[model samples]
Target: MPELLYWLDLFGVVVFAFSGALMAGRYQLDPFGVVVLSAVTAIGGGTIRDVILDTQVFWIKNPLYLYVILLTAILTIVLIRCPKRIPKRFLLIADAFGLALFAVLGTQKAMALGAPISVSIVMGTLTGVAGGMIRDVICNVIPLILRQEIYATAAILGGGLYVFFNYLGWSENFSIIFAILGALKLRLAAIYWQVSLPAFQIIEKNDV
Candidate 1:
């Protein structure tokens, strides 16, 4: 079980790392900045999760994950210099996959730590979105979830589904596949239809 989670974590990190590098490249950031954003986007959530869970940082304990993140970032930088334009559409697809992967991994970790379902869901969403949020902040842009776009909500739905299926004694592989598809569908649907959360309304002040 531990080894399974480790592999899932690495896969999620790779997907997010690519997404961050692509975004940084699009913004024309220098190579160093690109690598920085990729690292943050790949590892930020797992760092937070480890801190909150009072465990040794997962990536530090497993250095291969960091190595993979760096390698992918550098590879992405090379792609930026290619003559062909990289499709922005692929970034959304990568983000969806990353979100789904993190959601299930986070939920499983939280459950293993004996957290309740509500807490597990919150952690799962945080794990799914924290990296992207940090990447945007570092890149000096609005967080993706705060935009009029679908992001964190999709992660939450997927994480909830993962926990529900697990409680039903479903196979781990089946649960993961279901959660991943749910997240991808939700995100793609929102992107295609421009669905978003409600914006905050300003309250009028009463004259005394």
Candidate 2:
């Protein structure tokens, strides 16, 4: 289980790093700025999760993750220099994959640490969104979670389903797979169909 989680973490880091690099490219940031953003987008959520959980930060403990982020950043820069620009949709897809993987992984970690289901779900959602939130803030854009689209909503639902499957005596691998797929499907559907939750609005009244 630990080995599987390690690989999944690396995968999530790479994908998230790509998304961050894409944003840096869009803004025409220098190479150092690109790598900095990639590192933040790759590990920001996991760092927060570990801090809140009082666990060792994963990347600090395993410097391999940092190496992976550095390699991913370099690859992204190389891709950026290609004749074709990276598609905007690719960023969304990568973000969705990261969201799904982190959601399940966070929930599983919290559960393993004896947290209750509710707290586990919240941790999962936070793990899924934190990196992207930081990325957007640094990029001076509205965070995707704050957008009308079902971002955190997908993570929440995925986490809930993970707990549900665990309660049903499902295998850990099965539960994780189900949660990731569920979250990814919902996110992709939302993106493809432009589905979004209604925005909050305030009305103004003039008094005589």
Top TM-score model: 2
Model 2, 1-208: lDDT tens digits are: 6777778878999999999988888888899899999999989998999999999998888899888888998998886697656567988899999999998899998999999999999999989899999999988998888777889889998899899999999988889888889998999999899898787788888975
Q: In lDDT terms, how accurate is model 1? A: 0.83
lDDT: worst 10-residue window of model 1: 1-10
The per-prediction CA RMSD against the true structure, in angstroms, equals 2.2, 1.7
Error of 1 at 20 (Å): 1.4
Per-residue alpha-carbon lDDT of candidate 1 for residues 59-95, written as tens digits (9 for 90 to 100): 8887888789889989877765776586767777777
Give the per-residue Cα lDDT of candidate 1 at 95.
Answer: 78
